[model samples]
Target: MKRRDILKLAALAGASAVVPGVLSEVRAGPIGHTGPYWITIQAGWGWDPTLFCDPKGAPVNATYDKAQIAKAGNIPYAPSNENDAFFGKYASRLCVVNGIELSTHQIEAAFRQMWTGALEPGYPSLAALLAAGLGGGAPMPLISAGGFEETAGLVPRTRLVGAQPLDWASLTAPSADMASLFSPMTETRIAQYRRERLKAKLATSLPPGIKSVIEAAEAAELSRPKLEQWKAHWPSPLSDDPSRALIQLTLAAFKAKLSVSANLWWMLDPAVTDAAQVENFNDWTARFDVLMDEIEAFGLDNSVILVASSGGGRTPMYLDEQMKGHWSVGSMLLLGPGIPGNRIIGGTDENLRGLPLDPSTLEPNPTGVRLRPAHIHRALRRLAGIEASAEAKAFPLDAEDLPLFS
Candidate 1:
């Protein structure tokens, strides 16, 4: 029979018949250490570190012992004692870090929450550590709320899963090409095309060895219909809001153990201040809380880490005019095994300066000023048993300014 005829016949087979054997071989393995999971929440917006973790409490100055203030900078302590009450409930599980230099923009309310624990900047770094601890593999490092972006940190071009850069726009309105590939109808059509194309091409160049391989692959893909299977496996339709999809995707990735790191970016652009946007943000946050509740239900606290945060600072135009230009500092929170409980670490100035002070040396400079986000990442890595240094080597900073898990 003609090779074209053989190719046509093979295409009639489905993908399951051919793909299963291959997929089983690629499944990820169990975690290397069974250590506690490390969850990192990456708050994209500039999070005011002062809110949840304060140093020397809002009114900071020369009157306050510079050394003492520096030492106490990352610890949550306010003079009026008003802010301290906010985080009283979670005090045991919380460790507030202050005086760490931040590299993003801030909003007022987010800053307020940081000092008071009313708002928590969930981060991605912590999540990556946890996923790694769970024995997942690369290409799934961080799953953002919308999608991954270039600015989302982590060394790009690596084998890390979920490391591919994502833009929020892609989440809401995925490219036509991707949509076509992921669509069931399109896959069916493409399968047909593959069959027809294979036949036409084989008629012209039919090398016996190549023909055999093509026939086998075509027969395998046809027999099982991998695209149909993938369509079936694709997550249930989620809300168009990228944030909601983000939470759902992260949960799915974790449940499937397909990725070791996933970053969920909750809405960051202040431009999304419309009613729809607010509702989307609230809904997404609620979904995130639900995810946490689910994790707790499974008693898998030690297996997963959830870190939350904004992208950059909010613009004055986005906030009340009275609070223009005054951005809030960012925040960080963690809940899982191997983490201290009910404790708040770090402090923020009344003006919202997160100053990190060395309690032992009693000094505060840019290097000593605040809890660097990288320190939190380092701490999480330590918890996960990853030896990577958290702080950027080129940057002058110390991890001691932050609290350690006891």
Candidate 2:
């Protein structure tokens, strides 16, 4: 294809999903990874548990009565949105964990705690850790559209939101008419000279920091071609919807073996407002349903482990009679072939405090510990079979190991 045509296609479809640093140059055929892909979709801004997977009654939420709560198999969900349809379709595949107690209800702290199992900044997100821990040969390893961009420098962090048109003219050749400015023989000499200079510099003593940078540059050069090869798998006629576009690009990377885990974000429509909270949440669920369909269509339903959650939970009561404030207790939904679904672990009291669950039974145990993101992360590391990996050990989550997936 003409380089211009490729740039035009990327611009029109927002191909911001491309890998960076080492993801430039010539194109080749796809490279595929076969099993156990990881995806985490987090709802930006706090979401209301009373209106989502964890339904509460009366003074908690005057919007819906407790009597209106509905059940899908063993799960009880708020009657808002297309809950009946959504839950009916995936309840058997879902492991809903309510009452996630956070150390703080503030947005930033909550986000850090929610995904990294750390209350402090600087920890890599679960997505990053998983990609670094379990990643085997994927070029990008971890990609994020939005939500917890930190990778703790453990893996290459690729973002699928700001891909710009490359200077293909300069990249491929000096001009459109010519493939190269020099003959193949001259090109070979030039390459040898460049390598000799790089090797000579490396052989000399240098500052530790500069030496590391030079070594990293060499690694980047080596990985560039693999990233280029992944271009053959980019979806044609990309979807216009942002959410769908993100999913499409992510799946393409997954199928091409360029990435192992991705973090995507969605938010309640700001225009929907509190008066239409139901509509906002409905929109969220509909997108999730579409995600489910997209995965299944790619024949990845069985291989993808999905986690859907919010940065934090909104309080049941409205603040300033306009909107809900952050609540310390939140919830998360896990689904995949690996987890036994149709299970509800943990709970919240009427006042919206997290109730503890017995570590052994995963049942409500007032005397037991409240479920936290650390616990979930610990369980997730085990579930992905990477708890013992050096990557996991380097950035540890000092959390109690719980049998969350059983």
Candidate 3:
């Protein structure tokens, strides 16, 4: 495909999710990495606990029954009727944390707290932090499928699919006409110009954020081969669900040994919840099961950290027996290496209200403080072994440590 045609296609997509970096010469080597991939699966909008994680507290006459609550060793999960497929495959490895309130009623605030740990600016999403910490020398350390993802520090984001995925594919391959543009003399001149421009740009006083962008631009100029490497491993059948497609892309990156973390999201449409809750969660969990299978097959199971979270929790089953607005509490699931499996943390009243949990014990503590995104942030920092570093420490968790987890 022609390079202009690719750009045209990308332009047609309305908005662009630009991959951060410069776009000039080809990169010399494939981006590879050791183990330990941190991945976050977003159960966005508001999630129904009865349908997936907190079924135990659902009303006695709700859509899901207590009998459906299954135990695989020590894990107690209340999956919707249609979610047997997901629970069946992942129950053993799952660690379900309940009654942890995100402690916010506002949607936007909830979103910021869920991913970034704090309500303040300059602190990027957990995915960005992990990518920076885990991806030592990779150009694209962080990858996102659209969430509260940001580069708080000097790290760069990679929107490979961008405004148009098909156009992105073209970037991985250069047609004969496109290749002809790169001649020896032209390459030398362009490289020299870039160096000079970079030096001049550096000499000027620029904000840290702008400086990072400039640096990313320089890196992008030389990421052609890396993009091509990604294109070569792109999954076929990309899938109708954007999140699943991201899963494929993330898995492909892992198999190619390129990145350490990727973020994904799933939606909870309130209007459709009354009728489609069962089908929705069944599909979501099933896709997650597929991800687990792929990770295990890659022999990186112990090196991977899988986190499932959301911005809000759904209201109780009411009049029509469907979930409604956001609640102060929600659920989070953590699986993968070093994380204890088959355990449930925190608790709620029998009526499904979220209560605080002692971070140190991972148990309910009304007298203690409520758990927020910042607390999870710190615990995760400890779990991933980056809590002590200056970068990781810069974004401290709001609550205290959950020693039981460590």
Instruction: List TM-scores for all candidates, in order.
Output: 0.49, 0.87, 0.80
Error of 2 at 9 (Å): 3.2
**Deviation from native of the Cα of residue 249 in model 3, angstroms:** 2.3
Question: Per-residue lDDT for 44 in model 1?
Answer: 38
RMSD for all candidates, in order, please. Answer: 13.1, 3.7, 4.5
**Residue range 283-394, candidate 1, lDDT tens digits:** 4445556566555643555676555454323222334522324344444565556766654555445555665565444345456535555556555555656545342222
Model 3, residue pairs in steric clash: 21-220, 22-217, 22-220, 22-221, 23-221, 24-221, 359-402, 374-397
Best by lDDT: 2
lDDT of 2 by residue, 127-226 (tens): 9888877773456788788766688877766676655654322322323344456776776576567657756778999998877656655544445556
The TM-score ranking, best first, is: 2, 3, 1
- Measured on C-alpha atoms, candidate 3 has an lDDT of 0.65
The candidate scoring highest on TM-score is 2
**Per-residue C-alpha lDDT of model 3 across residues 139-180, encoded as one tens digit per residue:** 556666766777775466655434444445444442324457
The per-candidate count of clashes, in order, stands at: 116, 0, 8
Better of 2 and 3 by lDDT: 2
Which regions of candidate 3 are displaced past 4 Å?
1-32, 57-61, 79-81, 120-122, 160-165, 169-176, 180-214, 235-244, 271-274, 297-299, 317-323, 355-369
Better of 1 and 2 by lDDT: 2
- Ranking the candidates on lDDT from highest down gives 2, 3, 1
List the global CA lDDT of all models. 0.40, 0.74, 0.65
